[model samples]
Target: MPMGCPFLSLRFSLFLSLSFATSSSPFSFFKLQSPSSSIPKATSSDLLSLLASPSHSSSVNPSVADELKSCFKFLVPFTPINTRSSSDFKSPSSRRSLLKSLRDEQNELIWWPPEPVLELARLAFDSGGDPDSIHRALDPTVMPVPDVEGSKEDKCELTRTPYGRRFISQELNSYLEYLFKLIVERGPDVGLKVSLNRYDLFHGHLFIATETGRLGILFHAKEYPLYDKQVFPYYLGYCQKDSNVTYDDSINLRNILWLAPLPSNSTQGWIAPGVLLVLDAHPGGIVYRDLIPEYVNVVRTIYEDDLGNVVVDVNYLNVGDSQPDYQIFIC
Candidate 1:
């Protein structure tokens, strides 16, 4: 647990109204909201009960449930551009070279006015209740595909279409609920002390530090960055087609991202506004969980809705499983 953890004070009836700071480094804690504030509060007990259960239950009060749902509104559904096994290249070198070429091409499309950029521009408008402005900000042009040698048209096809074709609505909701429950289970004191890894942040992967000197949860660190490009590539396109994929187990992509509090360090650079939390799974390679064994006693939560929809939620990476596929909670 963190030193003098504020979560302990939460039990004393504290109400936190969290808002990201609008600065180059936006990691500071904001002012607390009074009990009578319009923002709903998630009591310490309410959080603990959600955490204690393996799945989602309506046992908690409606206010806490509403707040939990609101946290996920800004999350953008996503998929990876390429995986190691998605091609028929016999050698690792061949696959690596091709993946790099594709990533470089996709990087050029992240500018404002594209599909994702256009969608992102609407978040503020939607929240502010200005529906008329959402479409006005979009650039409807179909982006031009990159023309590179070797794959040429194929590379262009991969670059322009890199996100997931279909959003996993049920799974995404379950993942967020499970994440919130984990924090509550850790208690307020423990949550305050969690740290973010600088190395992971630089590569856009998220690493959470739970205990005093150990690593917590690691999301989207499965694939090593391209040997030439030190920074891990972010996919602006969609998943590869199964017909073009020749690698074994290439289709087993479980995309999920953790949207949580990040610790700010002087060297980590600017924090982008309205960031989305999308978790990417490990490439077709051996999976490694936590480096430290002490942090590997995994606990999965199952949330059941009134409609009898069951969600057995597990974190992205399987930290302790010898065969990660079998241990994965989601099918």
Candidate 2:
């Protein structure tokens, strides 16, 4: 391996070699081993239980820490798009290349006629009656399906973004929930492993728990701007509570554009929104913002009825293309 040769000169070779440890996917709800076990439909209590468990509070995993460091590197503006020596893996070129590709592929959705849920809710409020009557006046072809299925229906309907498949649901919580499944139950079972890698703006730093009540992994160094793009940065921290991912100290991602908050496109039948954005801070800790004069974007929230019906809850017409500051809570 020469100094800059495929292995010696570039770090990508070393990264490929780091998988010495391997892990990690999919199943139906009814077939699982839970209270319902049939559809994998987790109730509030189940979620609460997981959140209450201490296993989630483990010390940060070194790989995840490195990956996160890489993400912060991306927040820096036009840092040299060099290779990364991520964790045991060497070379950062792959991450830099991967991020450039991802950025190129991102696409924003269009603002449109207000979605049905919000429209219906408003109509009912104005008419002093349920908007159910609107059903008779419209065509059914455009109606939302009670249940959307895909290759991995049990996992979740995929999340979409201007940058391609970025999240599961439109709500922040929904996307986090999907991630929770992967990290907690799924990531550990097989050879799946997560690091704070190139998937910037998607997660904050977290430790993978090795046991019920002990620290398993640790990684991080207040190392900011961990990527070639260097557009966003976040301070990774361990959770104090079990299974709970709450950050006692508020993390502001507005310092860098890469970490800006994403719009929640729930009405599009997406389960969550904005779970992918990570943010950074300026030199003096001031959020450097741009007065973007663009407009005519929209966001919609959706609600479903128990009998298996879909409805819009609220919708907003965002006046510009810029994103807001938000904390990413990847379970």
Candidate 3:
């Protein structure tokens, strides 16, 4: 495992104050409460139980229950039934039957929140252990929309329109932008002050998958202050690949998310994990046939940077057919 850099040590924290208003949408049932308020925070076990079996809890709001059911239905295939000690599965056949039933229950037309956003909701649940936070994280209205046209200089100059743009909806785009901002905002504190570039070129699709098993948008270089000349050189070096692969031929900006080293448990060396969240839902997948090598090459370069490189593991999680794909690259 890679360790944290002493020069880039910083703690990332997300502070959310949730307040809800009544709306017809299923997600509107989540009411926001301040962290400082008297309401007790839900434990991890409590949240897992609610997500695993929302029907059993009478206190769960009807609308929220409906949403949880949708999420549960979507997550069933990817969740490992055997590892769940709390589940009362009698045999392998019963587990398979249940999974099949869950898959059959899925409605093709119903709109569920994007997989990356849902994964972020899961992460929020794990960190804060609050059900409301999960809903708040999935709420599109609360997410910040990226100002693509406003910040041109800060963006990387792309040779062409991103391949994944067509598949991403406006709502999903906002959610991806929100995630980029959150990561940058919560990134390690180095000597420099990190900020969002707010450029569309900084955002694209990497042909990657999210936790829900669907492709997602890539938010590259969200933390690096692109305007700074000293920092810009490193950004260019990071993107530099083989001479045969031109800027147009390579996955230049697609893989670079945050440049700063994040806090990690390992004490060996600096560990900067690059996360790829695929939100695109096109059945045919987005990567151009010729550019597939570019994507693989970038991942290869990150892992095998030095001659005596340490072994780094990349974890992937997939769920439903339409769910987004999620991958974590520790470099």
Candidate 4:
């Protein structure tokens, strides 16, 4: 969570207001509305109901609605922070005790707006093209990456290995760049700014600055050798393993990307919790599988279940395969 420059922070916020003016104030601008305005104030329960209901009947684009439903079903229970409460703690003393026990678990429970998902989905569907198309338009060779010594010519490309190649192929890299720009272009409409924070080749982390938040996107290549039916748990186990063979000295396992929201103070100086999205590129296309439960499980095990994480994934182009469409795994 490196600190971003002040300019980056300002730009993100500024762009957000411009891009998302229609929906940015669901939380912040509530206080400014005139009392006599015909618009009714929205409650957390109301919002929850809206989110839980399928958008099949709505006038929204079918693709956008479908994408929204896929991504937001997991977030139905979350209430706005200003009006949030827990039924478990009945008494004031009990609430204080619970808070003390968890050392600010309440604070970690963050509230997020749902409008962005719809907006993002709109953009995705509007493109009229899929990730597969983008993937096919580029060269197949895995692009070479420079070595740690700042010499690309002298050292053999570290990512040239079969697994590495799959992880950072030229097409995927190009798609990544395109996606970043597309997301940023919506900043002004969404009332936030978007910028690149940094790309740490050493850690394989791509950081982005969005509105008042920063996101760290990790490139993960699923190892066929390590594949398991219970994929999420297995990946976490692998992330926890030490670098050495078991039953011997210390062995540190390679880090796998865990699905979670941006940290409180994530990349750059962003303080807001950004959205957590997963894109899985298989031979068929890029699929957006449901990872909400896995993300919550991982975050809760490592920390308290404060604010839950928001999960979003892109819909893949149907490649005429028998593989079923990705669905929301309600838990």
**Top candidate, metric lDDT:** 3
Model 1 stretches astray by more than 4 angstroms = 1-135, 140-143, 153-156, 159-331
Q: lDDT score of model 2?
A: 0.21
lDDT against the true structure, each candidate: 0.23, 0.21, 0.25, 0.24
* Winner on TM-score (1 vs 4): 4
lDDT tens digits by residue: candidate 2, 84-202: 21131122122222334432323110111113322332333333333343333233333221221121223221112111121122442333233322232222222223222111112
Over 1-331, each residue of candidate 1 has an lDDT whose tens digit, in order, gives 0001222321111112112212332212322223454444444234222322122225666765544333221132222212222233122222223335532323222111123322323332233423223233333433232221212332222221321111133343243334433332322221121111111110112222221111112222111111111121112111111122121221112122332211112222111111233211122111111111111101000111111111121222222324322111221
Per-model TM-score, in order, reads 0.20, 0.17, 0.25, 0.22
Worst 10 residues of 2 by lDDT: 293-302
Rank ordering of all candidates by TM-score, starting from the highest: 3, 4, 1, 2
Give the residue spans of candidate 4 off by over 4 A.
1-65, 71-204, 209-214, 219-331
lDDT for model 4 comes to: 0.24
How do the residues 259-319 of candidate 4 rate in per-residue lDDT, one tens digit apiece? 2222222121112222322222111110111221222211111111111222212111111
Candidate 3 residue-wise lDDT, 60-119, digit = tens: 444433333332212112232222232342222233333344324331101123344334
210, model 2: CA deviation in Å? 39
Q: What value does the lDDT take at residue 185 in candidate 2?
A: 28
